[model samples]
Target: MSFYSGIDLHSNNHVVVVIDEEDNKVVDKRIDNNLHTTLEVLAP
Candidate 1:
């Protein structure tokens, strides 16, 4: 199965959405704009 990720970027934070092959949402997160924070939000 494959996964897809979409990010809604903002000046101070981001909204991240991850979906599975069937288009079911797996993760929905809002995190700071920092690189480390963004990576942590997307990490498995």
Candidate 2:
């Protein structure tokens, strides 16, 4: 299986989406607007 990721960054927050090889969304989240926090939110 393969996976992909997408992130939408704004001034206040971030929207993250993860999809699989079949193009099905696996994870979706709204997270804090910082590098550490964003990484934490997206970490496996």
Candidate 3:
């Protein structure tokens, strides 16, 4: 299956979302601006 992701970035936090090819949500949450945290949430 294929997946897609998007992020709304701000100064201190970000909202990240991941969806499948079928438009089903895989991950949808807000995370800290830290790269590690963002990557962790984006991980498959």
**Where does candidate 1 have its weakest 10-residue lDDT segment?**
35-44
7-27: candidate 1 lDDT, tens digit per residue: 999988989999999999999
Q: What is the lDDT of residue 38 in candidate 1?
A: 77
Task: Report the CA-based lDDT of candidate 1 relative to the real structure.
Answer: 0.90
Write one digit per residue (lDDT tens) for candidate 3, span 1-44: 89998999988898998999999999989988999888777765
**Which residue pairs does candidate 1 place in steric collision?**
none
Candidate 2 stretches with Cα past 4 Å from truth are none
Task: Return the clash pairs for model 3, or none.
Answer: none
For each candidate in turn, give its C-alpha RMSD to the true structure in angstroms: 0.9, 1.2, 0.8
Give the poorly placed runs of model 1, Cα more than 4 Å off: none
The residue-level lDDT of candidate 3 at 33 comes to 90
lDDT of model number 3: 0.88
User: If both were scored by lDDT, which would come out higher, candidate 2 or candidate 3?
Assistant: 3
**TM agreement with the true structure for every prediction:** 0.86, 0.77, 0.88
- Give the poorly placed runs of model 3, Cα more than 4 Å off: none
* Deviation (Å) of 6 in candidate 3: 0.3
Q: How does residue 25 of candidate 2 score in lDDT?
A: 88
